[model samples]
Target: MSYEMKPLEFISVKFSIGLLLGISCGWLFPIPQELAILLSTICLVITSLFFLFENYRKGIYFGIAAFLSFISLGIVAITLAQPKLSAHHYSRDYNQDNGFWILELREVLKPTNFNRRYIFQVHALNDSARSGLILGSIQKEDKISDLKVDNHLLYYGKVHPISPPLNPYQFAYDSYMESKGVYDQIYLNPENSIQLKTTGKSLKGWAAQIQLHIKKELSSTPLGVKEQGVLRAILLGQRNDLDPEVYRSYKDAGAVHILAVSGLHIGILLLIIRFFLKPLMSSYFGRSTSMIVTLLILWVYALFTGVSPSVVRAVAMFSFITYALYLKRPTSAINILALSFLAILLIQPKFLFQVGFQLSYAAVFTIGWIYPLLIRFWRPRNRFIKRLWKLFAVSLSAQLGVLPLCLYYFHQFPGAFLVSSMLIIPFLGILLGLGILLVLLASLKSLPDSLALVYNQMIRTMNELIGYIASQENFIIRQIPMDRPGLVLLSVIIILLVLSLQKKKFVYLCFLGIAIAGFQVWNLYLLHQNRQKNEVMILHQVASTAILYQNGDVLYVMTNDSMRIKTLVENFELNRRIQSTRSIPVPNSFYLGQDQWILLDSSGILPPVRKNIKGLILTQSPRIHLGRILEQSCPDRIIADGSNYADDIRRWRRSCQIYGIPFYSTAEMGALSLGQL
Candidate 1:
C-alpha cells in the first residue's frame, strides 16, 4: 500500500525528474531574458526549500530535485550563451533565407533508385555561420556520375532556411536534422565557379577516407562488386556505393536492416570480444583489464562509425552491462536501460523526438522484456535449440517493437523481415568477425594472399546467401501509413500493459492482443479520417506533373508522364482499392497546345467536355498559356505548383484580382487540401 525507496525507485525518480526538466526546458526554449531570470529564481528557491528538509527521504527527494534544477540552470546558461536565433526550427512556416552563407559537401544518406532522389547532409567549411549544416537532394544521375566524396570539386550553392516536408506518414527530415542542429536547405548551382578548400579535415572527412580505404582493400581481393558492397555496408555502414538493384532486392525481401549497422552489429562485436576473453575472465586482473579493453574498443568503434545516435545508445547500454558482469554484481536490465535513457536525455533532450532514438530504444526494451518470456514458453532442449529459439525470439521481439514506428515513419513494412532476419542474423556474427579479421589482415602487408582469398570467398558466399533469401517469392513489401498520434498512443499502451501485467504469460497475451487490435483499430480510424480529408498534393516531378485527389473510396491521380504515374501509384499504393476513372488528353483548349493534362473524377463530377469552363485548375504555370487561360476560363481559383513559379507571385496575384477570384500557391500555403463538396 506504501511506496518503498530503493535503487529501482531511482529509475522512476530520474525519469520523472527528466520529464519535468524537459517540459521546463521546452517552455524556456528561445528563452526571453525576463522568463529565464524568473524560472532560474524559482528553481533556486525550490532547491533551497528541498535542501532545508532534514528527513532522509525528504532530503533525498530534495537533493534529486535540486540536482535537476541545477541541470536546468546549466541548460539556460547554454541557451543564453548561443545566439538566440541559431537553433533551427522545423516548422512549416519557417523562412528559407535571412541566414549567413556557408558551403557544405557531405555524402547522401538514402538509396538512389530510379524513382527516388538521394538526400544528403553537407559538411560546411570556411563560413563561420551559426548553424552550418544543410540538407539537399541530388539526382541519381548526377550522383552516379559526378559525386565522389573527397575528390568532388566544390560548387557555389545558395543556403536557405526551409521548413521540413509536410508528409505526416513519411520521414521527418526536418525533425531529424533539428535534433542535430540543422535547419536549412541548400540548392547547388552546377555552373557557379568555386575554389575547393582542402585545408581542414573533419570526422566526416575521416569516415570518407576510411570508406575509400575499405573499398581499395576489397577491390584487391577476389570479391565481386556486389559482395564487396554488402561487406562495406554491413561492416562500416557505407551503403552509398551499393548497387541499386541489390539494395532494392534486400529491401523487398526484408533483409535491408542487415546492411544497417545496428544493435545486432554491436552485439556481434561484443560476442566476438567475449569469445576471446572467456578464458581471461576467470582471473581477477584479466577480468578487469579485459572489460576495460572491450569497453574502450567498442566505444572507439562507435566513434569510428560516426556515432549515430542509435549506435551510441547501444554501445552505452552494452558497456554498462559488461561493467556489471565484470564487477560480479547483478544488474536489472530495465533499470540499466532506464539509466541510459536518463543519461542520454539529460545530455540531448531534443533526441527524445528523434525516430532512430525512439526505435532503437523500443526494439531493445522489447527484446529485454518480451524475449525472455517468449523463450520461457518454448524451452529449448539443447544448446543448438536454445540458440535457434533465441534468434526467433529476438527477431519477433524487435519486429513487433519497431512495427508501429516503421508504419508511421516509412509507411511500409517488409513482410519477409522475420524469416529473413532468422536466416541472416546468425551469419551476421560471422560476417562481423571475418570483417574485423579482414581489416586487420589487410593492414599487414606481409599477410598471405591465400588467406585473404579464403576470407573473400567466405564473405562472397554469405552475400550470395543473403541475396538468395531476399529473392524469395513469399517476401512481401506492404505500405501501412499511421500518423504520429496513432504511433505514439499505440507505443504507450503496449509499453504500459506490458509493464503492468502481473504474470509473464498474461504480459505476452496482453502485448499480442494490443498489437493486433490496436493496428486494426488504428488503421481503420486512419482510413475513415482520410476519407473526409479531400485535398490536392503536388509532388516534386522532374519532367512532368502529378496531382492526387481523394473522395470517399475514389482516388484520382492526374499525370501525363507514365513514369510519374508509376511513382504516384506505388508511393500511394492506389491500386489496392481506389477506382481509376479514365485517361483524358492534355486539355489544349485552356491555354497551351500539346500540354499534358491528367485528371480524375473522385467526386463523381465530370469535367466540361466542350466548353472552356468558368474555372481552370492549372497545376503549374508556364510562359506559353498564362494569358490564354486568364482570357478563357475566368477561373474562380487557380492553384499552381509553387516550386517553379514562386517568382511569379506579383503577376499571379494581379491576374487573380482582375478576374475577381482567389489564387493559392503551394509555396506560400504549404501542401494544399480541399474538402469534398
Candidate 2:
C-alpha cells in the first residue's frame, strides 16, 4: 500500500520557490538597475491585470504572472542592493587618494593579526554629505580607547579597493565584502584620524552599551573567564572573548551552533517560554496576552543580542509559528516556514547567498520533515526511550540536511555530532534559562557569587565533554572534496530518497537513482579531467617563493621556505583530486615541457644560455640589472614571486615596460599560471 499524497495546502510554497528561482537568476545573470526596474514595472502591471480579470485569476495564468513579477522584483532588489550602481556611492564620486571623510563606526569586526577592523558608514567626503560603507582598519599598536558602535570619526586616508583572492579556489574576500555593500577599505594613520563626539545613538549602539554593562557587571562575579566568554556568546551573541581552543573544540564537536545564538537557541528559549505560559492558554484573554508577551520577549532578546541577522531570522520565523499556533487554525508548519523564507528573501535577497541562512533553513526544514518520519518508524512506549529517540531523530535529520553544505564550504563533517547533540541538547533549555536568569540578576547587581560559581561549573563540565568528543579525531572526516555541481546533485538525491521513503513511491526512487547516477558521472568526469591536467603555477606566499608543477595525477612543489604548508597543499590536492604530491627544494633552473625557465635569486647570477629562455623568474629580491637581463636573455616574459622585495619588483616592472616585455607579479596579480604547458 502506498502512502496517500496530500493536496497542495499552501500556495505560498509555490510562490516561495518561484521567488527563490527568480532571486537565483537575478544573481547569476545581473541586469542593469534601470532595466530591472522597467521589467519589474511591466511584470507588476501584467500580474495586476491577471488578478483583476476574473477569468485569468482562477488558473495557471495568474500563477505564471505572479512568478514573473517576483522574478522581476528579485532582479530589481539585487540590482538596487549594489551600492556601486548608486550615483551617490563613495567609490563612484570620491577620490581614491588622500581625502577627508566623516565615517561612523557601525560594526566591530574580528581583529586580524596586524589590525583591528570596523565597518564604517561613510557620512561625508570633502565635507559633502553622502551615504556609503567602507572598511576601516587601525593598527593594533595605535588602538583607540573606548571605541563603540555609532562612534563618528574624521579620517584622512587613501581608500583602496578590496583585493581579490591571490590563489585559485581561495576564499574571495572582495566578493564577500561587495555582497555586504562595502566596496573599499581605508587604513587609518594615527596622526590623521580623530574621534568625533556624537549625541544621537542608534538602537545598535544602545545594544552594545547594554552588552558592555552586562560584561562589566559579570566581571565582579566569581565566574571563570572562559565561562564568562561562553555566557556572553550565549546571551549577548558576542564571541570576541571566547578562547580559541574552546571554540575549536566546539566546532570539531559540531556543537558550535549552540554558542552562536541561532535557530536552535531561539527555539529552545521559545519552548521554555511556552511551557511557562501553558496555564495562560486556558483563557482567550490570557492566551492573547501571553502571545503578546512572548513576542515582546523574543524581539527584545533578538535586539539585545546585537540584532544579528541570524537572531532576527530565527525570531521572525518563530514569531510567525507562534501566531499561527495561538490562532487555533489548521496551519501547515511547512507553509509557515516557507512564508518566513519568502519574507526574509524579499527584504534581504542577498541573504539567499549567505551560508548561515542556507544552513539554518536547511536544518530546520529537514528536522520538520524527517523527525516525524523517524518517529513513525519506531514508537517507543518508555518515556525516556521516546525522548532519546526524538533527540536522535532531530539531530540525525539536521546533520543530513547540512552535510552537503558543510562539505562544500568547510570540507569536513564531525562524526561525533550525534553524540554531542544527544548529550548536550537535553540540558540546553535549562542552561539557557539559567544563563538568562543569571544575566538579568547580574544586570540588576543582585547575582550572588554562589549562583555564578554553579553556572561556571556547568559551563566547564560542558566544555570538557565537548573537548572529549572532539579529541576522537579518527571519526572526524576532513578534506572531503565537493564542488557546486556535486552539491546540487547530492541535494537532489537526498531529497528524492527522503520523498521515496516517506511516500513509498517508485517514481521518487527512480529520480533518486538518476540523481545518484548524475553525481557519480560528475565525479568520474572530474577525475578524468584531473588525470589529463598539466600546468605550472607560481604561488603567492609571504616572504617565500613556491612553484607548482602538475603532470597528470601528480603534483610537484618546489619551495625555498621550510614552513609547513601541508594544509595548503592538502586543499590544493582536494580541489585537483590528485593522486599524489612530491616536494623538492627550489632549483635555479626548471623546464616546462620543452621550454626552459631560469630563477634569479639574491645572488643575481645569470647563467650563460645557448638559446633564448621561455621566461625569467625573479625571487629573493634579485639585484641583477633587469635591462641587462632583458638585453641578454630576451625571454618572452618576466615573472616575480612573492620572495622579491616590492621596491625591486617595481624597478623590474619599470624595466619590463621600458623593454616592452610582459611582466607578472604573484603579489599583485596573483599566482601566475602557465596553462597546459
Candidate 3:
C-alpha cells in the first residue's frame, strides 16, 4: 500500500485512465464533426511533438509529466476519431420505406429456433445507393444453415427500430443492440420472396466454416451430446450448443471462465507445446525455435476461435510477455494488462462498456497487484502447500476485484466459487491438454476409444462436481441489489482492506469497516423510502400480467395467471427489500389514496366507471367495446398490461385515439405508474 509505482507501471496506469476518461467525455458530450476532427489532429501533433522532443528534456519529474501529457493527448485524439463510427448514417425515411433491399450479410449471428439473424449492409435499396447496418432475420429451416457471412440476400420488408424493454428493470434489449451498432430490424420470411447469392469468402466466413466442420467431427464422437457441447465451448469459444442448465451450473459454481478461454487456457496450451517438443528443444537454437513456434501456435489458436474479445485479450497480454522474453527485456504484468486494455479500446471504444471486458481486466489486474501481497503474508514450507496456497490467494484476489461488479449486475454471490476453483483449477491444465489431444485425434480420425473414454470421463467428472457445488443453494446469496454508489465504495474498501494487511495500517481497516457500514445504512434508508411508497403499478412482461397496489409496508399483487407470480415479483420484492408478498386473485377493486381501480380481464367484466375511478385496467385480452364503454362512463385513462394480445392492444389504442381518450399500454411504454408514488 505504501509502495511507489515503477516508472513504467505509473505511465501505463495513467495512460489507461486518461484513455477511459477521454472516451467517457466523448460519449457524454459529442462535439461537431469538424471540431472533433480538428481537435483530434491537433492532439496527435502535440503527442508526436512530445515524444520527439522528450530527449531534449532533463529531470525525471519533467519526463514523467511530458509522457503523461503525451498519452493524454493521444487518447484525446482516439476519442475524437470516434465520429468516424457514425460517418455513414441511415436516412430519416429509411424505416418508413418498405421495399426489396439487396444487402450483403456482413456478420452472421447464431441461429435461433425460428430464425437466422445477420447484420447486413445495405448495398442497394431498390437499386438506389444507400448504406447502413440492418439487423436481418430470415426464417429458419434445414437449408438456411447454408447461409454464410458475406452472402448477398434480397429481402422485402420494412426496417423498424428495435423496441425497448416492456418492463421495469428488464434487460435493455434495444440498448444492447444499439451498442453493437444495430438500430433497425428487417424481419423476413425467406420461405417466400427471399433471394440468396453466395459472395466471395471472408475471414469470418472461413472461420465459421472451419468451426462448423470441427463441430461435425466432434458430434460424430462417442461423447455425450451435452458433454461434447461443453468441450466445444472450452476449446472453440462456442456455447450456443450448450444446455442452459449446464451453462447455469458452471456460472453458479463460479467456474464459468473455463468456458470463456482466457489466460489459463492459453497458458496451458503454451506449456503443453513446450513440454511435448522438449526432446527436439535441447539445443539453444531449438529453445528459440520452440518459443517462436509456441507464439505462432497461440496466435493460430486465437484466429481459430474467431478472434473473440476474451481470447484476444489473453493472447495480447501473453504475446507481450512472450515478446519481452524473446527479445530479452524486463516485463511487468500491470504494464502488459494496461497496454492490452488500451489497445483493445483504441480499436473499438465501445468495448469499454462490455461487462466481459471490464471483469476480465479487473480480475487480471487484481491478481497481479494483490496476489503477491497475499502470498507474502504467509510462506508455506512445502512446495505443494505453496502451490495450493497460491491458488487460493489468487482466487481470493480475483474475486475481491470482481465481487462488487458482480453484485451490482447479477445481484447474487456464488459462495462456492473458492471451493469450485480449488477443486477444478489444479487439474485444468491437464484437462485442457487431454482435451486438445482428444480434438487432434478425433479430427485426424485416429482417436482410440480408451483415450476418448478417459477424456470424456474427466469432463463428466468435472461437470458433475461443478453441478453439485452449484446446487448448494443455501450458500448462494441472492438479491443483494448493490447500486452504483454502494458498489464503488465496496470496491475501494476491499482495496484498502488488502492494503491494510500489506502496510499494517489499522486505520485502513477502520476505513474499510466504515465503508461497509455506510453501504448498509444507505441500503436501509432506501428500504425505508420504498416502505413509505404508495402506488399502483402494472408490470410489463411477455404474455403475462401482474398489477401491484402497495400502501405503506403492505403489498397486494393481482395477476391473471399464478404460475409466473414468483418470477414477476422477484425484482419488485427486491426493490422493496421485502421478503413477504401476497399474491391475490384478480379482485373486484383496489384503492390508492383517493383513486379507485376496477379489475377487468378476459371475462369482460366492466364495472361502472366515474370520475373517481382513476383508471380502467385491462388484462387477458378483454373482449369488449371500448368506445361504447367510454361513452357510457368516463375514466382518466385506459391501461392494459402484457397479458393482452398485441393486435387487441393496437385495436384498443385506435379506438381510444378516435374517442380522444388517453391510452397507455405496458407493452408499449413499459410499466404504468398510477395513483400516488
Candidate 4:
C-alpha cells in the first residue's frame, strides 16, 4: 500500500519556512522593538480582516485569506523570536571595562585549539546585577577539570564583542555565536578566576557533571589519545579532543557526520536498544515498556550530547516515531519530519540559521521523500543485495539533498562519498555500537583491558582507512563557487526536479528544463558582471601584508611573506570567482586607470607624493614623519596594511588625525575594498 500524505503534512512545513524567513528578515534588518510591535499589530489586523471575509464566503476570498494567514503567521513568529534585550541593553561603558564580576557558568563549550570556552550568564557585573550570555574563555591549564558548568565564579575580565571575519569568504564567527544567543566575550585568567563551590541543582548541570565524569574516565583508559577522541565523539558527541589531522580525515572521507550525534547515530542507538530488549518485543505490555525505555534512553543521550541542534532534532524525530508506535497511531515520515522541525523552530527560532540544523533536517526529510522512489527503480533478488541497495538509495537521496548546502558553505564536494558510505558505514555502525557499550562500562569502572585494546586497534584501523581514502586527491573536489543566489537557485531546481520525478509529468519536466537553462544563464550573467570589475583591496592579516588588485576576472596579488600566498589568494578567488591570481613583488608604484598607489616601506623617507599619486600604501613599519609627508605630498587616504607594527600604526594614525588625512586601518575596518579608479 502506498503511503498517502496527510492533508496537514505541509502545514507545519509552510509555517516553518515563513517563520525562518521572518526571523532572517528581523535579524538581517532588525527594527526597533516599537516598530516591530507596530508591524505585528498591523499584520494581525489584516489577518483578522481576511478571516472575516472568509467567514462571509465572499467570492473565492478564502484563497487570499489563506495566503494572508501565512504572512501574518510569519510576522507573528518574528515578533515572538525577537530578542528581549534592547539594542543597547549592555551598558556602553562595559565595552572595554574590566572588573571583578560573578558569572554563572551555564554551558560548557567544546574546547578549541586556543582555549577552553564556556557560555556564562552574568550574575553581577562589577557588583552591579546584570544578565546576558557571555562567551567565557579560560586559558588551558593543568586544572581544567575544576571549571565545570553550573559553578559560579568570581573573575576579573575584559568585555569584548565577537570580532567579524578578518578575511573575505571566511566564516562569520560573530553571527554564528549571535545565533546561539551569545553577544559578548570575557577572557578570564584560569588561575586567578575563583570558582565558587555553590552549583546550581539543574538537569543541565547534572548532565554536564555526568559528561565530565565520563570524559575523566575516558582519559584514564589505555587507548591512545586519537582513538579515545574518536570513541568519545562517536559515543558521547564530544570531539574537542580530536586531533586536527584526524578531523580532516573524517571530513574529507565524508564521515564527519558520524562524529556528530545526529539522526543516524540516534537511529543506530535505537536499533541497539531494541536488539537488547528482544525478549520483551514478543508481548504487547513488554513492547510498550521497551518503547518507553527507548525514549528515556534517547532523551538521556541527547542531554549527554549537550542538547545541540543535531541532538535535539534527532531526539525529537525519534520521540514522534516511538510514540506513534506506542499509541498505535498512523505516522507519515514527512509529517513527522515537518512536526519536529516546526517544534524546534518554535522553541529556538534562531536554529533556522544554523548549518547543522539545516543539514540534519534536509538529509532526513529527503531520505523520507526520495528513497522510496529510488528503491523502486531497481529490484534485487537476494535479501543481502536488497539491503545494500536500500543503503545506496538512502545515501544517494541524502547526498542529493545536502549537495547544494555543502557546496554553498564548505565549497567542496566529496566524490568518494558514495564509495565511502557503502564501504565504511556498516563497519562504523558496528564500531559505534561497541563504543557505546565501552563508554558505559568504562564509566562504571568495569571495562576489560582486552576489550579496550581491541576497540583501540579497530579505531586505528578505521582511521587509517579513512586517511587513505582522503589521500586520494581525485575524490576530494574543492573550491566550487556557490554563493547565496546560487544556493537558492539550485535548491529551487532540486525541489522542482524532485516533484517532476514523483509526478512523471511532461509539463513539469519542461518547466524543470527551463529552470535549469535559466539557472545556467544566470550563472553566466554573473560571471560576465564580475568580468568588468576593476578595484583593489588591502587585506588584513596579522604579521602579513597582501594587496589584491582585480581587473576583470584576473587578479594581481602583492605580498611580502616568504611563505606560499595560496591561502590568501584562494580565499579571494573563491569569493570573487577570479580567473587567475598572480603574486608579484612590492613595486615602487602601481597604477589603476589614472590613479596611482605610492608605497611607503622601511626606508623611513617620504617620497615625492605628487597629485597623481592619489593613494598611499603603508607597510614594513616606516618611520617617516607622516605629518611632514602630508605637507609634502598629500594622498587622498593613507592605507595601513597588517605588516606594520601596531605601535607604528598608532603613531601614524595620530599624525593623520592632526593633518586631517583619512587613515584607513584594515585591522579595524576589515579588508579595504576600494571602488574602480
Candidate 5:
C-alpha cells in the first residue's frame, strides 16, 4: 500500500491543532479578556492583510499570520467563555458571609447520598445583582419543596467554596466544578430557603417539561423502573433515574456507552432513518426531501437529548455526511470530524476539558481510522462471519483509541468488553429503533401495552446479559494507574504504530519503538518517585480520624474504621503503586521521623509529657481546654479531624488565632501532611 498527501490537504486539521494548543495554553495561563480580544483582533487582521496581498500570501509570513490567528482565536474563545470575565458574575461583588441570594435553578444534577444537587444561576445578592452559576445542595428529606428548572430560589446563607479531595490521588471535584463555571456551593435547609415562581422559560426548562412528561408516561407503561431508566437515557440522554446497580453493570461490561446517547446511538438512529427513506432516493427531489427530513429529525433528537457536546458533535458530523451523500460528493471523514471539533470548541471552549467530549471524538475518529485497517486483515467468506468481524474491528479500534483516557480517568478496563460488544452491537440497532418508536408512542399516550412489553423485555434481557458479563469478576481489571504523560506517550505509540503499518515505513516503526521506550522510562520515573515517598498523612473521614504513614513502598494506616476507609486506602495505594499496606488500631501517640504527634479523643485527656510536642491532634469531639493545652505544649500547630465537633473546632481556631499559632482543620483544608504543615 502507498499513500501521498499534499501539504495543504488538511487545513482544518492544522487549524484544529493550533486551536487546541491555544486553548490548553490559555487554560494553563489565563489572560485578561481584553488582552485576549486585542491579540485575536491583531492576528486576524494581519492574516486578512496577508491573504489580501497575493504576493505576500505565498511566503512563510502568511503561514505565521494564519497560525497566530488560529491560536489567538482559541485564546479569545476560552477567555470569553469565562464567566468571571463578565461584570455581573456573582463572585465579583456578592457578599459570601451574609446575604439573601436570589437564585434560579438551572439544572438538576445527580443527587448525592445526603443531598439533591443542582446548578443555580445567581440572580441577586441582597440588593446587588449577580450572575454566574453556583452549586446548590438541598438536604434530601420528606416534605422538601419541589424545585424545577428555571424556578427562582431565595435563601439566606453563606456560599462556601467547593471542597477539595481529602486524600492524595482522589478525584479533584473542586477542579471539575470550576471547569463547569461553578465555584461556590451552598447548603440549604428547608427552613432556610424557599422556592419562588418564575414566569420566564428557557430551552432547558422546555426540555425538562418534556422529560417530565415522558417520565410520567413511562410510569403508566409496563416497563420496569430500570427499563424505563435505560429507555430515558437512550432517547433523552437523561440518566438521573438510572438504577445504581444497573449503571454499574453497564460500566463494568463496557457497554455503558449504550446508555449514553453518543455517536453510536445517533449513528444507529441515522441508519434506521435512512433505511425507512431508502425508496425516496430514486428521484432527485426525493433525495433532497429525504436529506432535509433526516437532518431535521437528527437535530430535533439532538435538542431533545439536551444538546450535550457528544450529541451535538454526532449530529453535526453526520449532518455533513448526510449532505455529502445527498450531493454524491467525495468528502474526507477526517476533515468533517475536524470541522465539527473546531466548531464546537469555537462555541464552548470549556468542553475541551470534558471527559465525554474527549472520549466521544476519540472513539469516533479511531473507529473511522482503524476499523477499515483491521477489517482488511480478515476477509471472511460467510456474510454473518464478515459482519461479526467488522463489529469486532470497530469495537477493538474504539477501545484502543480510548484505552489511555480510560486508564487515566477511570483506572479500570473491562476485559469482557469484546464479549459484551459482540452481544450488544448487532442488537443495539433494533433496540434503539424499537425504543424510539415506543417513546414517541408513549409520549402521545398511544403506546400499546403489548409493544411496551416487548421493548421492556428486550431491555431486561440486554441488562441481564450485561450483568452476567460484569459478574465475571476475573475479567474486570480495576485500579490501573495512568498519568498525563503516560497517556500522551501511549497515544503517540498507537498513532505511530498505525502509521507504520499503513505506510509500510521503517522510519515510523523506529519512532514507534522510541515512543514505547519513552513510555517505559516515564513509568520508571513515576515508580522511583513513589518509592522515595516517606510521610504521614492525617486523612479526613467524616466522624472518624485516620492517619497514614508511608515508608518507601509500604503504607501503614492507623484507624479503627478499616471497613469505612477500605476503598480510599485501596485507591491511594493503587495510584501510588504501593507494594504493601498494613492496617493498625489508632494509637494515642505516634512518631514519624522528626515529627511527634499526640492524639486526644473524646476523653479529652492529654499526655503528661508535653515537651517537644510537634503537633496536637483533636478528634472525636474532644472537650479539652485548647487555650490551656496551647499554654502547656505550644506545639507547632493544632490539627483537628472531621470527628471533632464543629463548634469546638471554631473555639479552638479562635484560641489559636489569639495565641498566634497555626491551626489546621482537616474539614476545611482537607488531608494534612505533618511535614508540610
Candidate 6:
C-alpha cells in the first residue's frame, strides 16, 4: 500500500461521503425528496464502482475506506446538527410568532438614511403562530445610539415576505437572502417595541467591539471623512460609513473589490508575512512556526472583517496553500480551491447561489488557471512590463470568467474595469498595507501623532489619485441589457475558446468561435422578436405611477404626470431608438391633442350614446366612471391599473359586468400589449 495511493483513495471516499451528505441535507429543505434519494443512490453506486474497479490492495484500500468513512461521518454529523428543518420550515411560511429568533448578524446591509438598516443571518427564529419562519428584509428602526450586534431585545413588528423587486433588473433582496438561507422579512416598529435585555456574547460581538475600537482610533487620525471611511471599509469591512462619491470613484476605477476584504487583501497580508519571516524561513521549525502564525493571523483578520463568505473562502484557500508549503508538498491551487468550496458548501450550501460567492470563485479560478496560460502566450520582455502585463492578464482573466455571472446578477458591466484595475490593483495593495500598519500603530499606546499625520497624508494622496483617474472621460461605463440567455452562452463559448487556446487545439477553438457567433446571431433574433412584440408594461412606481404601451415602433404613454413620464423615459428607456411618441389623456381632460385622445368626464355624460373607440384604459379611481362612457362607446377592450384596484375585485367585476366589457388588470396580466385593431 503506497502512501500516495492512500491519500488518493481517501479523497475518493471523502468525495462520495460529501455527495451523499449534501444530498441528504438538501432534502431537508424544500427540494424534491425523490431527487435527493436519486442523488444519494447515484453517489452510492459511484462509490461502489470505484471500489470494484480499483484492484483490492489490503492496506491502501482499507486506509482509504476508513478515511472516507470518517469524513462521511463528520459531514453527516454536521448536517444533522444544523437547524436545517427549522430554517427550512420557517422559510416557507411567513405567519409565525415563536417570540424568538436566532441568526448570525452578517453585515449592516445599508443605512436607510438616518434610519439605519442592518442585514444579518436569522439563523433560526421561533414562530408562535407556526406559519414557518419568514426571512426577508427586516426593517427595524432604532435610535442611532442603541444599535449593536448580539444585543438581543424583544420587539414586535409586522413581517413582510421579501420577494424580487418589481423591476426585472432591480435588486432581488429575497434571492440574496435565500442564498444565505433566509426566507422572511421583519420590519420592526420603533414606537411600541420594548427592549428585553439578554446577557450573551458571540464571536461576532467581539469582532464588532474590535471594529468600534479601530473606528475610534481612526477618528482621531487627521484623515478626511472619505479617506477614513474607505480605509475602514478596506481594513474592517465597515462600508456603512463610506461616502457615496468616494465609493463611486472606486467603482468607476474598477477597484471596488479592494474595499471588500478578499483575495487581494489576503495576498497583501501574505506578502507582509513573507517579508517579516524572510530571516526565519532558513530553519524548518522557524518556517513552520511562521506559517502557523500567519494562518492564525489571517483567520483572525477574517473574523475581524465579519468572516464574510468571500473573506472565508480567501482565507481557507490561502491557509491550504500555506499548509502545503509548510509540509514541503506540491499543492495544486485549483485543487485547494475545490476543497475550500467543498468546505463552504458543507457549512452553508445556500451560498452556491450568492453572486459574491460565484464571483469570488470565478475570479480566483481565472487567476489560478487562465492567467498563467495567458502569460505564457503573451510573454513580455522587461521585468516591470511583465509585471504590468500580468496585472492586465489577471484583470482580463477575472473579467472574462465573471462576465456572465455579473451580467446575470447586475445586468450591467463596467467597460472601464480592465483599464481601472491596471492603475488600482498595485496602489490598492499599498493602501491596504498602510491601513493595516495604521491600525497596528493605533493599538499601541506609544504611537506618535506624526504617525497619524503621515497615514492621513498617504490616504489623501491615494484619494486624489483615484479621483483623477475616475474623472477621466475615457473610462467608459455603459449599462447594457443582459436579458438574453444567448449572451451568457456566448460568454461560456468565449471561456471555452480561451481554454482551448492553452492546449493549441485549433479545432476546439474554431468550434468555440462558431458557437460564439451563433449565440450572437441568436441573441439578435431574440432582441428583434422582443422588439416586434407589442408590450404594455405597468412600471413599479414609488413617487407616481406610469403605464407604457408599445405597438411596433410606436410608444404610447397614458400618464400626464411629468414626473412619472420622466421616470419611465429615463429608467426604462421607453423611447430608446424609435421616434414615435404619443400620449393618451386622463378622464377629466376633454380635448384630444395630436395623437393623444382625451376621455370625456362621465360625471354628466349621456350613457346611451355609442361612439367607436379604439381602447378604453383606466388610470386611477376617477377613471372608473369612464367604464360607463366606455360601455356607451363600446370600445374594443378595457384595461385598468392594478395598483389602483387594490383588493377591490368585486367593484372591478361589477363595473365590468355593467359595461359588458372584457377586463384585464395590470397586476394580473404582468405586461399587456394590444396590437393594431
Candidate 2 structure quality by residue, lDDT tens digits, 572-660: 78999878889888888877778888988889897666469999989899777789889978899999988888898899999999999
Question: Candidate 6: deviation at residue 657, Å?
Answer: 11
Candidate 5 lDDT over 255-373, as tens digits, reads 88888888888889889999999999888689899999999999988877776667887788788778777887655666667788888899989999999889988997787778778
lDDT of 6 by residue, 594-669 (tens): 1222232223333332256545555544434555566567665665554454545456657777867777665554
Q: Specify the poorest-scoring 10-residue window by lDDT in model 2.
A: 1-10
User: What lDDT is reached at residue 281 by model 5?
Assistant: 82
- In candidate 2, how many Å is residue 444 off? 3.1
Best by TM-score: 2
RMSD of each: 6.7, 2.5, 3.4, 3.4, 2.5, 6.5
What would the TM-score be for candidate 2 when compared with the true structure?
Answer: 0.95
lDDT of each: 0.60, 0.86, 0.75, 0.78, 0.86, 0.61
**Candidate that beats the other on lDDT, 3 or 4, i.e. the better one:** 4
Between candidates 4 and 5, the one scoring higher on TM-score is 5
lDDT accuracy of residue 463 in candidate 2: 95
lDDT of 2: 0.86
The regions of model 4 sitting more than 4 angstroms off are 1-10, 29-100, 110-115, 126-129, 138-146, 155-158, 190-194, 562-565, 605-612
Least accurate stretch of 10 residues (summed lDDT) in model 1?
A: 595-604
Error of 5 at 460 (Å): 1.5
Clashing pairs in 4: none
Lowest-lDDT window of 10 residues in candidate 4?
A: 1-10
